[model samples]
Target: MDAEQAHGPGGPRWWRGRGTPWRSTLLLTVFVFVGSAFAARMQQGERAELDLFARVLLLVACALLLWRRRYPVAVVFGTAVAVALYLGAGYPYGPVFLTVAVACFSAVVAGHRRAAWTALGLLCAVHLLVAYWLYRWLPPSGDAPASLGQELVVAGWVVAIVALAELARSRREQWARERAERAQAARRRADEERLRIARELHDVLAHSLSVINVQAGVGLALLDADPEQARTALTTIKSASKEALGEVRQVLDSLRTPGDAPRTPAPGLDRLPELVEQAARAGLTVEVAGEPPRLSPGTDLAAFRIVQEALTNVVRHSGSRHARVRIDEERGTLRLRIDDDGPATGADAGGGGNGLAGMRERAAALGGTIEAGPRADGGFRVLAVLPVKATAEGGEDQ
Candidate 1:
């Protein structure tokens, strides 16, 4: 949807406003000017002539009120002063009184509570003083009614108008607050989607690249040593490359069309042994000690990535010829613990740079946690715990 046509109160019409307060004030000023001018022309001919100066001053004050919303205190004071000066003239009550109401509202809308109160006090004082004077000595020439009750009723109506305007302003503020909250929620969802995309790409690239790298290395070694073994390794490399390409195409197609066919699900605990076998092929004696749990796809994916990274760490850092991995699921958490004996030589090796970091991030995203460090048993250990359902800890039942 267009920005102005977003989901909001007032059918999005409220969003179609000028960019700045100055423009809004200009529009209002032009409107007030035109309205006041029309009202003045309709006055009785003699009255219009006598109060020409009063009409001009009142129109100028009304037009000036465009800026009242921006600088409420200043405009209210200026307009109030002008109205007080013109009240004694033979001017009609409409325009002068309109200016007072606008001043009070503008002050309130500008968020100046103290100034609005001051403006209200000034408005009441000037109106009361003029009303008293008019009552004590009737201006027979003016068009005002003789009834005191009618005067009070008119004053009450003005007060009600100000209250209504304040109510509208508060409602508009509330709508703005709600709109901001919705925008924040949308941003959060977009962030999550981006993270998921990154996870898929990492898994697809890492596993596929590992297989390709191994096969390519084997092929290079057997280029003359054994053409038969070299051809087989080349075949594995071709198959791995083809699968990676297909997965990449599917990911790209899904992005272009949201309703594209779904791809195969990501592997989890069910393929833990297969993962271990793959590690074994790399000359690492990987021992799987416990039955991995059947978990939700998210938790399962986290576990798979955790084990993959842990074994990769063993192959990369631990000079150990053998590595042991154990997975235990209890109390709604699937935990994987992996340890490896030190490598043969004392040569220092760097640990998981992006691999371990990615594992920790995956665990965290699934409402899980991980720990990795050298163990006291002459080996290194990596541990990860993933929550199956909700992240909250379960009941401490005996």
Candidate 2:
């Protein structure tokens, strides 16, 4: 993973080897070599007597730009100071100062607003002073602009170039702001997704484990007292185990991103019968009514989970000996209804009913709906209805 991208979103899938030390070193070497070449090509026909000190300073400042992102303010100020001394040497300058201007712009874009302004101030001040001093020393040589008006034109040209560079700086800062906002939005979405997944895990695992725990205790107690009853207990354990595994698989599926590999097919609408069977094995008189058809993969999975969670709740919470699972497909939708004649008293009051909220959340995610409350008919009922497809599949019609 690239060090520059390791801390970024989705965990480094976009780190395409772009942040290596070798690449940075190579780029800096190229910049310094180009600055030296431009320095050597000064003056027309006459061998420009290059000041050794100025040439070395220009090379150092040009090479220093590689660290601009890491130390923008230092590089900007350092380059400005070096360029001043180079200009004061009274020799024709080169393209090295352009590199400093570029670095200043990057600093501005990196959220260092105050530092960027400070560097900009020092840059304009130092360059203006250098121009004035250079003009005084040799206002106009034979090859220089012939008139005061022409000299003023050359001065204007320099100012125009600086203005263009500052414009570039502003653009970089704008781009940086946009990138920051995008990152913040991504982080917020990730946090929300994590919370949702956590809620699902809590609901499914807590409810399933509570039923299994109670059934296991019953099996152990009857093991010595009645062999036939113990056999029934073992059967209940097997059914509960299957139901728990299925719910767990669904939660894992929900946590995965699209195109990722957790492609284990979830038990959908067809699995409602299996859930009712598990309740039967747990010694509850289980009954099923109506019929819900083949739904889309998402709807099917959510519907199955709702029934399974409801059955688990009945096995754990319903004090009565009977529970009914009612399912029906109507008007392009499927509704799952689970009710138990369980008295909300004693152990049943604070019973293992953690999966109810999770089931509701699952239904909501599918663009469906769920409602779980005490039925007016004196039983606990959970009703969930889901569309064949999500609202996101076909957004609101304008």
Candidate 3:
């Protein structure tokens, strides 16, 4: 069988192919010989010898178990019939019935529920018929005839064997279901990790490339008229490139070995001044207000990214050169707002692109909300509110 089928629910183990049949056959042979000898010794008046015909029947029944895994129902019925015939011919009760019971158990464990139950019913019915024959035809001297208690004891044994088989089947199925669920959970975790990495790369590269593009244009414009201005622009380009490379390497290192300490602490709201300075070099003036509040690592990183992306948008899309940033925390909510006095420029003015989506995902993941749009007063605005602590239901802390 293929690997998938072999490892699937109720699937046989690999070694079962080479081991189970021979082991079962050997066990049945030992049971048949030892039990028959024990039964003969248990005889009261005269110990009856196992005739050649009865011995042959017992051997046949034991040999039939070699095919039990392949033909469980057939083996059960064949062995039961052989044992019944041997008993009818006045042969002692031995382990011939054991082969039948083992076959029935194997059938159930192999996922043959209907066949196994049918074999069990047929075996019980044959046993009842044999009991009646022995009670009517065979006279008892001093001992009592076959009683209902004896029949019940035999039926109880059959029921116990079937119950054990059913228990094993249920346990196997439960384990299979659990294994499948664990596999699915692992796949889901892998997919989520891939999406997280993709979003990180998009955010880092997009912001860095936008800054580099602006600096290169500035350098090219001033290369002949003002060499010093061009040199300053080249310096900004170099700085942006170095920052991008460091952040990219950090991301790659995280992917290589998760849980390792980062080479540098992640930037948070404390780094807003650096972001504003970078924007100033790109010819945009930024005004700031309110102090950064204490935040969870995730919320802090998300707040930084939101402000970074908003400033990058101001530089790349807004015509106005001045922007305002506001940070406020009150009653367990940390609020951030960035606005620029520039006319709306297409969808970029109203939140479009992976940057905005990434911002939204981050805020929402922390039980927070973000809103971006063109303000009625002729400027673009982005606002976000994050909870101090995330709730179990992923809602804002109350």
The TM-score leader among the candidates is 3
Provide the clashing-pair count of each candidate structure.
3, 0, 0
Ranking by TM-score: 3, 1, 2
lDDT of 3 by residue, 278-370 (tens): 888778899999998887666777788889888888877888889999999989899999999987554242334778888888788787899
Structural RMSD, model 2: 6.9
Instruction: Output the better candidate (1/3) by TM-score.
Output: 3
- Look at candidate 1 and give me any clashing residue pairs: 319-343, 320-342, 320-343
Better of 1 and 3 by lDDT: 3
Error of 3 at 88 (Å): 5.1
- What is the per-residue lDDT of model 1 for residues 24-95, given as tens digits with 9 covering 90 to 100? 556655665566556556765423333467657766676666666445668778877777666545444454
Error of 1 at 264 (Å): 2.6
Every model's TM-score:
0.71, 0.65, 0.83
lDDT of 2 by residue, 1-398 (tens): 33223233211222222342346545655665575566667543322346677568767767666666666567667776776665555445556556566556545444444565576567556655545554455422332322567356546645654576567645654565688899998998788678666765665565556556767778899889988887877776677677678767876786667777665665666766665665566666778898777677667766776777777677666677788878777888777888888685445423444576777777777677899889777789888988866556322221
Number of clashing pairs, model 1? 3
Error of 1 at 147 (Å): 8.5
Estimate the Cα RMSD of every predicted model relative to the unseen true structure: 7.1, 6.9, 4.6
